[model samples]
Target: MPFMEFVNFYLMPGIVLGSIYALGAVGITLVFGILRFAHLAHGDLATLGAFAALGVVTIFGVSPWVALPVAMVACAFMAIGIDKLFYDYLSERPKIIVVMSSLGIALMLRAVVQVVWGVDTETYTRGIVRPDDYWGIRIRDREIYTIIAMFLIVGVLWAFLQKTKWGKAMRAMSDNPDLALLSGVDNRKITMLTWGIVGVLCAASGFFLGINTELKPLMGWTMLLPMFAAAILGGVGRVEGAVIGGLIVGIAEETSVLFIPGEYKAAMAFAILLLILLVRPTGLLKGKVL
Candidate 1:
C-alpha cells in the first residue's frame, strides 16, 4: 500500500482507537496505583456509561456531545455508590477477594446494561459521516474530536494532579497510604474522589468508542483486554506511560493486519502484555511493580 493509504486507513484509526484506550487505561492505572486493586469491572462501567449517554440522547433528544457530561456525572455517582456499597466494606480484606468481587461486579454491570439497553447494536446517529481530506489524508471530524478530547481531558487531569492540593493528597496516598493517613489525608474522601475521577474517564472512553463505531452491549467488554494491556504495558502508576502504551498497542493491532489475519488482531495485546511482564514488569517508564 502507498504511504498515504497506510496513514489514512491504518495509522489514523489506530490513533483514534488509542485515544479511547488511553482514557480507560488512565483510570486503571489510577486505581492500581492508589486503590491497589485490579478493577475488573472497569470496562463494564464504561459500558454502563455509554448506555447512560444513549439514554440521555434518546429521552432528551439532545446531541450526543451534549449528553456526554450528563453521562459522566451519572456514572461518577454510580461508581462512588459501588465503592461504598461493595468495595468499601472489603477494604481491610485481602486484595484477592476485592479483585474477585470486582469480577462479579463486572458481570452485574453488564447485566444491567443488557436489561436497560437491550442486546441490539445501536448508534448515536443514523447517517454516515464522510471523511474530510487534509492534504491527501482522510479523517473524519469525530476522529479529530476524539483525539483532541482525550488530550484535553488527560491534560487537565495531569494539571490537577501536579497543581492542586487535593491532587497532591491523592498522589501522596498513592505513594504511601499509611503516611498520607498519618498526615491527615482522609483516606475515605480520597477513595471516593478517585472513584469519581475513574467514572468520568470511563464515560469519556466509552462515549468516544461509541461515536467512532457502533455501540453493542459487549463493546466495552471486548475492549477490556486491550485497555488492561495498555495499562500494564505503560506501567501501573504512570499516567503518561499509559497514553504511550495505548498508542503503541493500537498501532500494532492495526498494522498487524498486514501480516496476520484480522481475526487474530486481538492477540497482539496479549503478546505485548506477556512480553512486557517478562522483560520489564516495571513498564516503559519504570513505574511501580505489581
Candidate 2:
C-alpha cells in the first residue's frame, strides 16, 4: 500500500481503538485516583454495558444511540451495587483485598454475560458498513462516532472537575481522602459519584468496541491490557494523560505490525507497560505513582 493509504488505514483505526481504550482507561484512572484500587473488573463491566445495550437494541428495536443511555444507567447502577456488596466491607482493609475482589467480579461478570447472551459472537447490526471517503481517506461512521464520543465525554468530565462542586469534592478525595473527609467532603457521596462516572465510561467504551467490531463474552477482557496501559501511561490520576497514553498505545499496536508479527500484536501493551514502569514510573504527565 502507498504511504497515505497506510496512514489512512492504520492510523485512523488506531485513533478509534485509542478512543475506546481511553474511555475505559479514564474510568480505571477515576476509580484508582478516588477509591485507590486496581479495579481488575473494569473491562468486564464494560462488557456488561455492551451486552446491556445489545439487549436494549434487540428488545426495543431502538437505535444504538438511543440504547446508549439505557446501558450506561444500567451499568452505573450495577457498579454501585457491586461496590456495596463486595468493596464496601473491604474498604477499611488493604486495597489489595479489593483488587482481588475485582478479579472475582470480572469472572462473575463474564460468566453472567455468557449466560445471558450465549457464547456466540454477535453484531449490533447486520450487513457490512462501507467506509465513507474524505479527501482520498476512508472512515467508518462508527469510528467517527467513537472519536467524537470520547472527546465529548472526557472533555465534559474535565470541565465538570474544574467547575462543579461535586467534581472538586471528588478531586479533593483523590488528592487526600482523610483530609477531604475532615473538610466536609462526604466520602460516601464521593465514592458513589466516582462509580457513576466510571460506569458511564465503561458503557461508552464497550459500546464503541462492539460497534467497531463484534461482541463476544471475552472482548472486554481482551481489551483490559491496553486500557490499563493507557491509564498507567497517562498517569493514574490524570484523565487527559489517559487519553494521550491510549492514543500512543493504540497507534503503537497498529504500527508495530510493520516491524513484528501480527500474532504478537496484543503484546504491545505489555511491552509498553514494562518500559514505562522501568523508566518513568509516574507516567508521561507526572501522574500518581502506583
Candidate 3:
C-alpha cells in the first residue's frame, strides 16, 4: 500500500481511536491511583454517557457538540451517586469486594442502557459523512475534534493537578491517604471531585466514540478490554503513561488487521496487556505496581 493510504486508513483512525481510549484510560488510572480499586463499571458508565448525549440531542434538538457538556454533567452526578450508594459502604472492606461490586454495577448500567435506548445502533446524525482530503491524507472534522478535545481535556486536567489546591490535595491523597488526612485534606470532597472528573472524561470518550463511529448498547462494553489494556500498559497510576499506552494499543490494533484477520484485532489488546504485565509490571513510566 502507498504511504498516504496507510496513513489515512490505519494511522489516522488509530490516532482518533487512541484519543478516545486515552480519555477512558486516564479516568481508569485516576481511580486506580486514588480510589485504589479497579472500576469494572467504567465502560458501562461511558455507555450511559453516550446515551445521555443522545438523549440531549434527541430531546433538546441540539447539535451533538452542544449536548456534550450536558451529558458530562449528567454523568458526573450519576458517578457520584453510584459512589455514594454502592462503593462508599464498601470502602473499609477488601478491594476485591469493591471490584466485584463494580462488575455488578456494570451489568446494571448496561441493562439500563438497553432498556432506555433499546438494542438498536444509533448515530449522532443521520446520513454518511465523507472524509475531507488534506494533501494526500483524508480525515473527518469529527476525527480532528476528537483528537483536539482529548488533548484539551487532558491538558486542563494536568494543569489542575499541578497548580490548584484541590488538585494537589487529590494527588496527596493518592500518594498517602493517611498523611493527607493528617494534613487536613478533606478526603470525601476529594473523592467526589475525582469521580466528577472521571465522569466527565468518560462522557467525553463515549461521545467521541459515538460521533466517530456508531453508538450501540454494547459499544462501550466492547471497548472495555482495550481501555483496560491501555491503562495497564501505560502504568496504573501515570496519566501520561496512559495516553502513550492508548496510542500504542490503538495503532497496534489497527495495524494488526494488515497481518492478521480483522476479526482477531480485539485480541491485540489482550496480547499487549499480557505482555506488559509480564515484562514490566511497573509500566512505561514506572507507576505504582498492582
Per-candidate TM equals 0.99, 0.99, 0.99
lDDT of 3 by residue, 194-233 (tens): 9999999999999999999999988888888999899988
Residue 126 in model 1: lDDT: 93
Clash count list over all predictions: 0, 1, 0
RMSD of 2: 0.8
How many Å off is the CA of 183 in candidate 2?
Answer: 0.9
Tell me the RMSD of model 3 versus the true structure: 0.8
Per-residue accuracy of model 1 over 177-233 as CA lDDT, tens digit each = 999999999999999999999999999999999999988888888888888889899
Displacement of residue 139 (Cα, Å) in model 3 is 0.3
Candidate 2 lDDT, 49-106, residue by residue in tens: 9999999999999999999999999999999999989999999899999999999999
- Show model 2 residue runs off by greater than 4 Å: none
